[model samples]
Target chain A: MFDAEKFIDQQVKKVRDEVEGRAIIAASGGVDSTVCAAIVSRAIGDRLLAVYVDTGFMRKGETANVDKMLGRLGVNHMVVDASDEYFDALKGVTDPERKRKVIGEKFIRVFEREAKKFDAGYLVQGTIAPDWIESGGGLRDTIKSHHNVGGLPADMHLKLVEPLRDLYKDEVRKVARALKIEVAEKQPFPGPALAIRVMGEPTRESVAIVREACAVTEDEIEKAAAAGEMKLPWQYFAVLLPVRSVGVQGDIRAYGFTIAVRAVDSVDAMSAVYSKIPHDVLERISTRITNTMKEKVNRVVYDITDKPPATIEWE
Target chain B: MVIDNGGQWTHREWRVLRDLGAESEIVPNTTPLENIKADGLVLSGGSPRVGLNAEAMGKCGEYIDKSGVPVIGICAGHQFMAAHLGGKAGPSKVPEFGKTLVSIDDEDDLFKGLPPTIVAWESHNDEVTELPPDFVPLAHSDNCAIQAMKHKTKPLYGLQFHPEVEHTDNGYEMFQAFIDVCQAHKKE
Candidate 1:
């Protein structure tokens, strides 16, 4: 029932009216932000600068891929490699909310520096409905402090602007299609990125293991979906759990970590059901992960829990 | 009017109404009774456990008592409705989440066009345990006894599962049926 063309026209006008001068958008190269960047660019033209920050917690090759993506969109953009700062700030931080808050504050600090050079006063985010709803405040209970909303510091210099605040992920995708953006159907990724995917301490070693496992999980799922073996899940990835299990690798006693393969089907990120990936596809994913990372990951299990019992991403 | 009790799907309820071509807005449950102007009202679910704390539900009790419109309660809202009306609501022995199969027992005004059994999405820590006087059970799931209920005379309804969410089967039609109920109540 949502009219994308009408929504786009109204949003462009609203952005033009609200933003008097220059603005810098936190473009994550995801559907919401990229679509946001496109709309903001249309409104402010060259006055809008798309700032993509690589927090060292992104997916494999995510930073470079986003870099090329922004170039193609023809939006004035820059990539800030704040990986070291993120890694350092997140050291010894284990709480899920704490990680989101820390990453949020760190993102603002990076954006502040960028804004000073670009002379921008407005900070545009691709924050959709679920981000704030799940974040919780006032009467609502805090489900999780999303990096964009509840994780935001109380005191910040930039005036916030979110064009997609009321819309959900599916609605955002509709807008993305209307705008003809390349990442229209991309899976929703948290702003905290791979940091939340790794449970407990997100040290360099843990992050690397999860990243590799995630890559393998994604590869196998995508391949199986392409081959018509299974429908592509709304979102799919691997989670690195802290608990260790014993296993036999190449006839040697190998003690290693476990990787949880998560895939869900949902219209919006608010509620989700575990994806019914075919047994053959799941076996392929499990075999590939254990074989590819035999030294570090010994066990791989699929997450069957739903949203109420378990969220999409593990802390 | 979609009364906001701070539930996650509260906005989804509002969106459903808007999509159905109804001019609807999400009014806080705390709002004064007189300020609300609508042909019907929807009591939204909340994060706070209605079974444990009813005060967190704000002025929802007042809205149900005096709003004088067709009303539908969901999740926590549904639980609060039964409790406020002298029924019983508490933590479910087997709380349901995500996917659930709800069997319609009455097919009241809200479930007019819906099938006897529907795949309803649910996320409730608490549920209506006992039927309030004059209220009849309309639906039930395997775990919970009262999945749906309706008043014998008044235009009131409650659903344990979320019909506003996309994953729910016939969610849109259910909303349209509610809209029809609201319209019929407005005429009366």
Candidate 2:
């Protein structure tokens, strides 16, 4: 049996012993990061500073919700509206690895700046096992460049402390439950944010298009699950592909981007089978996405590919 | 023990065995049978490109031929098993992937306590098209005909769907049944 309580007790002691002084943590408000923040806060008390960066690539309403969450937790935190910075850094970058490395280096520079302000020698992140595994080390094949693991700079200034390094996504959720964290049930969001979901170049306009598509995907999927039409998928979202197709919008020829909606069921993210979302729910999601963003997106399709061939996020 | 056939869930299969209180380890498929002294073997699921790399998966074929121990092949491993044993397997007519409802055709020791029908998790581009002689069909889905099969006289089984995944409701039950089969053979 996996004991979350025992794991929590040991991790807190480990964090307290490892983090000698003040530490700055990158709080993304996802289940992993939130649970990690809660655990680290219990260890260092007031010595921890939670920093959330609004990287413009975030999902709809992500920034505001995370801000409120930090305040409720009563953790000393700061919200850095670095959307412009991220957008500037990602300009004209299309290669997946380049995008991840750019974002990773940018994050470290931002944290190094904060680390100086707080005189914090440690930098905390919610990097779990999948982060490193998929990021691929010596013998492993690189699945995708996870920003936290793959994007990390070669010479980072601050010492890194990851409390949830060894745990899987499910284990992180258990820790969140054990600590009474409210965002325990929240679905996972990639560290690279919506950047990886945008198949090609991630521009300012491209980000806006995906943000709305993701919102619609979540709304329709969640509503259907609540209505008891189908069981909720472990993770569900929309990916805005760079490819465009011809479509008929009220008999007029329209050329627009295509959105690929994906959902999967998994205990740990190591392997996942595609979610068997009801056709009716998928139709609703398609109709809402194409109709709402008809000018920008006209074709909506569901990604039926499994994890072995297709990763959750399209890069 | 889990045979690492370059599959994504090879580790998960090992984890499931350990969780089920069975001694297990993920050994590469190329490991000699005598080296491990295992009671049974689990051939893990692999990539979408199953038929493309017969050379990479050739060792599994060798193991299935040489090792007479109780063996459970999963997904790509299942496809390879059928093909290796004079059966036919290729690109699935429907190319089934993701969650698909499977119906048990014949309840056997492999699917001992499982329900007649299950919402099993599936992820495969290729499937078993023809069963080898003496291999009996155990279960099937709408998209694919041979969802599962087992050797009539030998402790050999194959499953197209991933039983180690969390989505499968009776995943643990099936693993327990396989372990019991292994335990029985180990005693013999």
Model 1, range A1-315, lDDT digits (tens) per residue? 789999999999999999989999999999999999999999999999999998888889999999999999999999998889999999999998899999999999899899999999999999999899889987788888898898777888999999999999999999999999999999989999999999987778888998898899899999999989889999999999988999998899999989999999988877788999998988988898899888888998999988866787775
| Winner by TM-score | 1
* Model 1 chain A: lowest-lDDT 10 consecutive positions: A306-315
- Lowest lDDT 10-residue stretch of candidate 2 chain A: A133-142
TM-score of each: 0.98, 0.76
Q: Which stretches of candidate 1 lie over 4 Å from their true place?
A: none
Q: Which portion of correct inter-chain contacts appears in model 2?
A: 0.16
Superposed by TM-score, candidate 1 places the C-alpha of residue B107 at a distance from the truth, in angstroms, of: 0.9
Off by over 4 Å in 2: A14-23, A95-98, A112-123, A129-142, A153-168, A216-312, B1-3, B18-41, B47-71, B76-95, B100-106, B116-119, B125-157, B185-188
Best by DockQ: 1
